[model samples]
Target: MKHPTSYRTSIIGRTAGRLGVLTAACLTALAVAAPAEASTFSYPGHGVAVVHDRATTHADRAHPDQYRDSFAIHELGAVFGLGADNRATAVSAGCSASHPCRSIALSFQIVTMAGSHVRINATNLGRAVNEQCPGCQTLAGAYQFIVSTPAPFSLDAQARNQLAVIHHRLDALQTSNASIDDIKQRADALAAQVKTILDRAAAAAPKDREVNPLGTTGPSVTMHRHFDGPS
Candidate 1:
């Protein structure tokens, strides 16, 4: 009779060194997946030239004006009677160190104006702008507000929510052991849902009416998106 070969019942070929490396890798992956950073987004372009497409949460005064429109918040310009006008509405008294200033993205109807301050319907709150001209008023007033264009719900928020759902479904499909047909079916459904979401978001996106190109007329909002899954 041949002698039985010896073999350990434990994990085969997984030495202490290998185990340590595996554990370290798993920990690193977990660390990297702490949380998803909010994706930065901006609304449809003005149909002519480039559009303002960024927002800031942190306060910084890199420029001399300190608290000026900077067109950083061009939407705010529309609120101040800039309103799809081909020419920029100039502000005589820009936010300087002496004047003190701040700008914020708004998602509400501008009901009225109190000097440089504007009253919005959303949350019954008002914010101040850097307009020194007392007699100037918005030609488009409520319609000038971006939020008013897509009143009630923000298209950005809706798009983000749909994206989150799509991501979750994709993650599930990745880890699944379903058959080929099942996979294809699920994928098709997801694709349809994605198309619907995009249609809605595009419909909801804001437009500048006629902000650029002086007098040339063009299409309204043009909502566009791209996906670069997993950082």
Candidate 2:
């Protein structure tokens, strides 16, 4: 007759096999649920580029000088505009008093990845005031960034962080009715989170281990990134 212990071992092995199969099925489900997201904008090869014109307009009108400030916030980082123009031109100071304003055409490329998160390395192609010459009207202001997400539950964490920041900004703006402040706060927070995720992912990777088992080994996730253009 077979020993009881031997029979128990056989049973245990069968159970382990079933558990592995279940785990694989769950992972497959997660991968199926995860979705890819992206956004893009195109600007005319020529003309001025405007960054945060809406917010800047308010700031310029509110402040003594026609000075306005804006920022491009992404999950990876944020870029604040020191100055800008409607047409693609070299970053220049305020238009001369004689030529207070200039009309310039522009195009834009904006991509948002995942529902609440923005990716870096997303390219922005447009023309604005040339930063080199604060007063010159030449093709200027072309910004590019490399936005990266993290591994090991990185996507989920980033999404949560972004949602939290969005809610906080919405609340603050609604309470004070400060549109610019609200936008800025939300943008900054999102950029910080994206950067954090990317940084963490980079750090987690081993120098010699090119393969990130944590990101690819497990079940996948569903993600969405949203983008809205100028109305």
Candidate 3:
């Protein structure tokens, strides 16, 4: 006696209610099992970070400098130098101009600098590598950088534009195996310098309150990041 559409709708509603109950129960169980101070949420796949390194294509024959710059491709200071100390040893003691350490399978990362105010961590991405350097102190891994700021701040239109430009340059670095020389040349031709752009962006931000606690305004901010990769 009931309409087909109405009967199907009733059945669908009941099924949905059952599914909702099941989902809630599973979540509650997971919450109990999870740690007390678990800081991160499971990624919902909105944004994904990838290591677009050229050296990976020719790992066995890649130069140390080439391998090093691959990681430095990400230019943000907020997300630079993650697993750097480990990477540095290989650069300084591992190889030199005379005794080149060929066949580098060095693991590198760029992480946010630790601060009392901010808790920084990274969501690691699995990028498998064959051990080309035997008995070497190394890690072969990648990461998507994460930062939790002390205070919540919104990006203004100007700030958003500046960030867009920075992202473009970083994308170029990631996609190309361009040498420092070629990069510099292109920048020179275009009259754009990475340091200058970053300095301008930093200047636009408020002065460090801690730097001048007594005064209303702080001193000029000088922010710099240098890549200390092998030559």
Candidate 4:
């Protein structure tokens, strides 16, 4: 007769080996599944209107009395999608009221998206404003019609404005004569500060809220459907 202890040990070893193999297979399959690609779609009857105005008064002797006002308007129709992590991605084509038919594409991992409160903040500096000359006063403005599914998705304008200001400051610093290292340090610091503020605000805001369902007779697009249509 076989020893009971030996048989138990053999069975245990086999079970362990099977588990290991299964774990490895799972990991391998995930690796081969490919990074999720952003889906592209065209939105019909959707539009976005953005307007910006800026004014600057020179404080320097050479241009002490110089004042300049810049105005821009952006209009577009675009589509938005949610990533696996529930972030927002957008693609649009339209002209600012001032310009015409300029293409716009925005992709950012959303930190939070729920109810009337939708916060989409990104760490990218590309959208920062650039100050061409020093010692010049500057003012800027921007507007956007965020088209998202399920209608009634709203953003915190205050947060968006603060973020824009941060970017503007960073851009202004870049035009300064400060050393590259110094600029980078300052930029990083500013970025950190903005991030901290955003974090705190997010934490303070209420997480749970009532969400308006799709097809509720509000906006044309009511349902927040999958980025890709039903396969």
On TM-score, the leading prediction is: 3
What's the best-to-worst order under lDDT? Answer: 3, 4, 1, 2
How does model 1 score by TM-score?
0.27
Q: Report the Cα lDDT for residue 116, model 4.
A: 29
Regions of candidate 4 where Cα sits further than 4 Å from its true position: 1-111, 114-155, 209-231
**What are the per-model numbers of colliding residue pairs?**
0, 40, 2, 7
Candidate closer to the true structure by lDDT (higher is better), 2 or 4: 4
Selected candidate, larger lDDT, 2 vs 3? 3
Off by over 4 Å in 1: 1-155, 211-231
lDDT of 3 by residue, 96-144 (tens): 3443332222222322221122212222332322244332222222222
Measured by lDDT, the strongest candidate is 3
Over the stretch 1-231, how does candidate 4's per-residue lDDT look in tens digits? 211110000000000000011133433333233232221111233211111111222222222222121111111212121111111122112212332111111112112222222222111111212123332222221112223223223336776576556655644542355543454455446545555545544444432224533434222211111121001
- List the candidates' TM-scores in order: 0.27, 0.25, 0.30, 0.29
Candidates 3 and 4 compared by lDDT, better number = 3
Candidate 2 lDDT over 1-231, as tens digits, reads: 211110000000000001011133433343233331111121232111122211111101112122122222322111211111111121234444443332121211111122112111212333333222233222222222232222212224554465345434433332332333333445445445544544454444332224443444322122122222111
Q: List the residue pairs that clash in candidate 4.
A: 73-96, 73-97, 74-96, 94-101, 95-100, 95-101, 214-222
The lDDT of model 4 is 0.26
C-alpha local distance difference test of each model: 0.26, 0.25, 0.27, 0.26
